[model samples]
Target: MEIGFPNHPRRNLLKEIEWIGKNGFDFVDLFLEEDMATPEKVDVNKTRELLEKYDLGIVGHTAWYMPIGSPVKALRSACIAELKRYFRTFAELGVEYVNIHANWPGGLFTDKEGVKFQIETLKKLVEEAKEFGIKLMLEPLDTRFDTVKNISSILKAIPELYLHLDIGHTSLYGRKPEDFIKKFHARLKHVHLHDNNKSRDLHLPLGCGSIEWEKILKLLKKYYDGTITLEVFSRDRDYVLLARDKLIELWNKL
Candidate 1:
């Protein structure tokens, strides 16, 4: 199991990279959220140098603000453009997977329409990605305010697109993460392995939440051929360390 941490751009990325290397991590996911600045601001050449220096594999988390399913054609086009830019950066950095969220509902499209749009959008993105030799992994968000609520929905729409299964989101939505692995096992490309209480989308460390970590890890070992990213995020260093240690333990069990 190749372990990695999420990219919180608010933190000094180089420092974080050094810290991750010191702590024995081998990969990092560069998360691109709206409030966070673009990856362009960070010296890509220097970032790549550091990653190579630390021997860390990079993965990209695409932007969260743009709505790919927007009802307005202009908005959707803009979203696609921004996504392409992110994808381009991922390709340039030699990142393996570019993680994307499914289009939210009530944007420019209904749930069904959003799924259709997302599939179409993915087709275009996949074509573009092939040029860069990058793979796109579409993730299923929990039902909270998110547009894409379930794995089944995304699979039904575009069975061929790579999947990034977020176990914490699955548990929050009262769905079994194993179900996804069993059903979409072949399409799985990466994972966001975190835990949450039964109530919310809390990115808790392993074993602290209601998830069956043993069962999940067993299934992951059986079915997944991709990296397992521990997606715990918080300002507290102790929480991060505890979660990281627990995740390593779970990986050992596998």
Candidate 2:
């Protein structure tokens, strides 16, 4: 399994790229925040050049600012516009997969209605993405109360679309990561590998939380060929480095 690190616009991009290369990661997940969402700030051609220099592959994470299933029509439109721009950039960079979050709850659409709308949105996005040879993966988020809790509903709605399973979130919401893997085995494309305490989304390292790594890893190895991005962060750089090291070690053993 190939390992990857997450990149953000707030962080020094070039420095992070160089660091990933030096630290022996195979690829990087470009987390497209609002500032870096446009082609202006992040020149795809230049970014590709750097990745080529480091001999790294890229998988993109879509911007978190706009929710695809927002109740407001204007917000949804804006979100789509940003995503379209991102897709164009991905095409130029030769990036294959773009990870996207599913519809946020509290929208006009009910849980079921939201799923339908999201499926339609994704269907359109996938068609557009095909032109650029990029595939979109829908991610399921864990919520506090009653909401679209897991990926199962979304996956059921859009069977053809790919999946970006966030293992940490799955565990946080009381679902077995292995179960998700087995159930969504066919559509699973990429993964966000992190750990979290039950109470909050802490983004801890693999062994630091309650997730069962060996079982999950064994199940993952059976199906997935995509990068496992360690999505953890803290104010302390040492903590990040330690988590990165531990994840690499675990991946090697698996």
Candidate 3:
């Protein structure tokens, strides 16, 4: 399996790419987010050069806060337009899959209406992705739509969409990571690996949380053999490296 790490959006995009490549990661889960690393701020030509220099692959990650599911028609349209703009940059960077979080509609709509808005917004995105030859992936977040049943509904509506499974998120919403794997393993195109306390999305290193990594890795081995982003968020960069090593060890053992 090819393993990678995400660039903290608040940091320098080119510098993060250099470090990810130099440190022996297979790719960068390039998070195109605000304050610094947005689509407009990214230096695409230089970023591409660095990735090629290290022989790395790429997966596109969008800002999780984008309100694609807002009940307001204008807001949804703006979000879709922004994503389509980002897809052009991803295409230039040789990215194949671009990921977006499941949008939470909040109290503005009922669960059914929220899910409906999400599906309608994503349909436009899927069509836009086709024009750029980039596949779209949906990552279920802690929301009304986080359950497998809701996720299944979205996937059924958009047959061209793929799944981006985040192991940490599964802990937050009373859903186990295994449930998602069992239900949609065939549709999974990308994965995010991080540990959580089963109460919060702490983004801890592999062994620091209550998650049963050995069991999860074993299940993944049976179905998924693609890009996994080590999403350990810590001030200590060593934690990220330690998590990476732990993941590789457990994966090999399984």
Candidate 4:
């Protein structure tokens, strides 16, 4: 399995890429945010040259609050425009997988209507994404939603879609990370590995929280071999490398 990390809020894209290369990471999960690789700010050729220089692979992640299919028409339209630019950037850079959120806030729509609207918007985006040879993974965020939270409900909603499973989010539904791996191993295209206290999204290092990483790592080795981003974060910045080493050590033990 290939293991890597994402950019920090304080750093620039070039600095993050340099760190990934120096630290011997396989690929990078590009978190699209301000001061990072946002739609308008991302330079295509520069991004390509950096990736090539670092010998790195890249996958995209939309910002947590950037909901492209928002229920609000004006905001949703702006988001769609932003995401269209992002998808075009992904294709130009040869990004095969782009993680996207499942739902937006506001309870205006009923469950059935909400799912249908999300599907419609996704299908439209998928049509555009296919032209660039990109597939959008439904990131089932641990939020208040009827259809997109559970693996079973999400699969039934969009059977053709791949999943970008956040390990920490599994705790929100009272499910083990390995359970999703065992059941939907075939459909998981990207993974976000972190830990929490099972009460909130803490983004702690793997073993520092309530997660069972030994069994989780063993299950991961047995069932899946794909890109995993060490999804731990800290303001101190040193925790980034520390967490990466710890996860690698635990992963190696398995």
- Candidate 1, residue 116: CA error in Å? 1.5
Ranking of candidates on TM-score, top first: 3, 1, 2, 4
Root-mean-square deviation (CA) per prediction: 2.5, 2.4, 1.0, 2.4
Better of 1 and 4 by lDDT: 4
lDDT of each residue in 210-238, candidate 4, tens digit only: 88878878887787788999888766657
Q: How many clashes (backbone N, Cα, C below 3 Å) per candidate? A: 3, 0, 0, 0
User: What TM-score number comes out for model 2?
Assistant: 0.89
List candidate 2 stretches off by more than 4 Å.
107-109, 144-150, 252-254
> 1-254 in candidate 1: lDDT tens per residue?
68888767676667777777666777887775544436565667877888888888887887655666666667777877777777777777888778777666563446667666666677777777777787788887776433234446756666557878888887764677777778777888889877789668888777778889888888888876567778887677577778778777766767
To one decimal, what is the Cα RMSD in angstroms of model 4 from the true structure? Answer: 2.4
State each model's CA lDDT, in order: 0.73, 0.73, 0.90, 0.75
Taking all chains together, each candidate's TM-score versus the true structure is: 0.89, 0.89, 0.98, 0.88
- Evaluated with TM-score, which candidate comes out highest? 3
The TM-score of candidate 1 is 0.89
TM-score of candidate 3 relative to the true fold? 0.98
Error of 2 at 232 (Å): 1.2
Off by over 4 Å in 1: 35-37, 107-109, 144-150, 156-160
Q: How accurate is candidate 4 locally (lDDT)?
A: 0.75
The positional error of residue 64 in candidate 1, measured at the CA in angstroms, is 3.0
Work out how many backbone clashes candidate 4 has. 0
